[model samples]
Target: MSAFPKRDFRASMTWLHSWAGIIPTLLFFAVFWMGTLSVFDKEIDRWMQPESRYAGPPIAYDLDASIETFIGAQNGVEVTSLFIMPPKPREPYLYFYGVLAEEVNGKTYSYGRFVGESNEMLGEPQSLAGSGFIFPFHFKLHIPGNFGYYLIGAVALAMLVLTVTGVIAHRKIIADFFTFRPTRKARRVTLDLHNLMGVVGLPFYFLFALSGLYIFAGWFAALPMQTVDGVMGKSPVAFLELADSQSPKRRPRAGQSIAMDKAIMPFKTQAEALWSERYGAPVMADRVRIEHYGDANATVIVHRVFPGRRVTMAQDRIDFDYATGTVLYDQQATPATATRSWLEGLHFVQFEHWPLRWLFFAGGAAGCILTATGALFWMRSREKKAGAQPFNIRFVHAMTVGSVTGIMLATGVFFVANRFIALGALPPGIAPIEWEPITFYIAWLLSFIHAAARGRSAWMDQCFFIAILSLSAAVLNWVTTGDHLIKTMTTGMWSIAGMDLLLLLTSALSAWSAIHLRGKARQRPFAVQGDDPALQPAE
Candidate 1:
């Protein structure tokens, strides 16, 4: 049955879009903001860890040396897997990551270390920083286990539905693309801005939502897997083992340690040549993985980093026998696998193209604006219907103010906390790596409290606070690291310099937004109009 009058598909869709969007707008905004930042998570890592600013890729590119260093550092620890990631265009330091057999509180953990060009350990902060904190937060919001993944997957599904309904509802949304009236009434302006952002960013928003859902298809498949398992009397573990049996098996470990130099010689000599010949480009491996390092059947997998390519990070791989360096298996993606890889690449923006990365960032920001404004529009329309705002309206108002402004404040706090943790200025017993999320949650909670207590002024207050915190973070980096913006830019250390510049830019933008919000609050009476028009769409 039609939700509205017959032939009023637009009206029905409008109602569906509004309610559906408002339901998950805040969560959607958080995902969009974090996902956008994650596009440059590696650059952010370089910014966070100043010791990693080593100009460019190491000239020697010694995988064996890095692996040896890692093994020495974590002596006596049984490593389950070892990965060596050599520096590439965006990442300029050798990174050695491994999964160890050691269990902490019944949970296994992974450790990553940074290696300088000289094959020596670089003392960088032992924090997740951007890649660890921000990137995962994008998909999971740091929710423990599969819950976060399932939550994000649900949100992605909702986003897809909302996008479709929004398109159907906004019959003249294309016309609104070129029609933005800033001087109009608050309600009209918010509506127009929301339409503008939604229409302009439709393609990006749609693809992001679809790709995100596709990425987490495993979570969505769990229920069906259980059903199939129950019907077939098969366990997931057994299925996994059956699948693994097709791959190369690890032989018994040899008592004597394998020669690292001899193991990687084949990769260093012929891996790149093979990849370049196959891909028709001068592809070079940036990462290598060695399984069963000391075992008779050790395997070495080399991964190529293809920069400035399309949204398909083929990352061509070739596996070799550790002892003989003979080709064991070359990863060749099937058509369906290649399509999936391309979609994943599109969402992650792994290809090294700054312009495309910036465009994706902008599109994500626009999605955030769209979500925030949509929530505010609902509040405004509700207020217009009733002379006074109800409990639900006020609650949503506070939530909108808290979440939208709160996240920005929390991000600023996270950056500042990173610097403090790096300088050892934080209080005792607070591990720098763990303190990031703590500081973020604390700031976010305070924003909610301030939003409730201070009412409408909280937006302006938090914006101002974000500006201060952002500026302070930039200044702290300069003071602590001595990597001033001017010096970094002059020396062509863009990783650090670009981050500092962005922080300052964020500060300026926050200050401007705070001032604008303050002016708007003063000019417009809180209850002058029946409509609330609580928030403005951001540029």
Candidate 2:
């Protein structure tokens, strides 16, 4: 039945699967795991900052008043950006960004977190309310702008290709779907896991890759189209011009300011009315953007859309004059923009409810497991032949342990560092925001080196490391936040205490695997592949 000298389809796939699975394992591991935790990104911020506890009336002060007071408080301060918050369940803090000082003429005071009404610091100054570092590293590792994005794009493309090739090469899709022949040598065991996870998580894996790639499509895939539009007949500028042409261009006077008291509710209602008129049906308003602060002619733009629609498809761009608060420009989405809007919406998961978010999180975790198991299969399949190729095997092994076990440890370390730095246990001069990356990288590097030197024993070493890191993360939270497992359960502070329980689970699994592995080592080599004389070396 086969055309090649590899004989059986299974044998041919053995060769193809090794390379396909191994090549992108580490990159995908980083992507998937980070994405999993990113689902709870906001929760991580809440857990880190203990002082944000409040059901107090939402701060409804005048926008202009807050801006002027904050500006006056800091001489030579410039507000680069500001983010206003809606009445969300987790964090109701209105965020402000600008240069400021803790002391007059002091070394550019870096309290970026303590922002609110009249520049009156809302929460504790030393709290870790903004864990901005962890979320970004999950994608491109924050390598200056588009570079990280391109790298992720490359990996996503590889995932697409690998999935396609893997499906074609496998002949027993249905049979392998439920199979896990762990006793049939190391190679069989590895192959089983790779097939099982890959098959089971195929839909999720494809969506993640495709969606992730779409997010960067503008940078990589759509660049040529953008370039063509820019160069040909002034077409590129049409979209931006379209948005700007229909939107308000009114600039407010420099000195005058007006109160935006209860501005949000009315703005939302009116914007909805305008959209309903345009679209021939009602739509809900999502976000409000206030522009040109400290001016009489300032405008507010309200975004209205269907509740489950993508961000791009919103009947967006409604403007109102600040002084008279009269509607100026109201634009609705055309049928042509609907597809782009829907794709953009699908990519962002903007319409996700809490249940949907958790489901997304579960999908992300399954992707992580799928990637990890794929890497493990690559290593185990080559265990015997790789004996002569120690460094190559070691490198793969290191990546396997480092990315799989090491990242878990690194994440634990990150939370631990957050607790220490947030509680003021870490010394001064150490920038709190920068500490998360430093600790995570340090943990990753240490695990990589440890995995290389220790060989198969690195698994044990990493298991122990993970066990320690997970338990320590929980313990640190208890010590710093005064919230333990029982208290967290009773009071519903699951974010902080649930993180600890996860660590305990990780520890238990690692401990059990380590003991089993140690016992199995005496019978034969811990992981040995079949010795087939005809099996050719990797090309």
In terms of TM-score, the best-performing candidate is 1
Extract clashing residue pairs from model 1: none
Tens-digit lDDT string for candidate 2 (432-514): 75676777789888988888888888877777777777778778878876778898777776665556676788778878877
- For model 1, residues 1-539, the per-residue Cα lDDT tens digits are 54444546666677778777877767887898898788889878887776666664344566666677777776677765566777677776666656566754333433455544576765435667788789978997876445677788888988888878888877576566699889777787777888888888988888988888876673345444444333221221233323333456434456556655574745755888986787698776766777666666677877664445667757466878888868877775567677777777798787878889889988988988898888877777766665564777677877888778898899999888888766888888987768888999998888888888887788889989999998999999999888898898988878788788889998999899999999999998574353333332110
TM-score per candidate: 0.88, 0.79
Candidate 2, backbone clash total: 2
Q: List the RMSD of every prediction in angstroms.
A: 5.1, 6.4
TM-score of 1: 0.88
Candidate 2, residue 248: Cα displacement in angstroms equals 9.4
Q: What is the C-alpha lDDT of each candidate?
A: 0.74, 0.63
TM-score of 2: 0.79
In model 1, the worst 10-residue window by lDDT is 231-240
Clash pairs, model 2 backbone:
252-297, 310-345
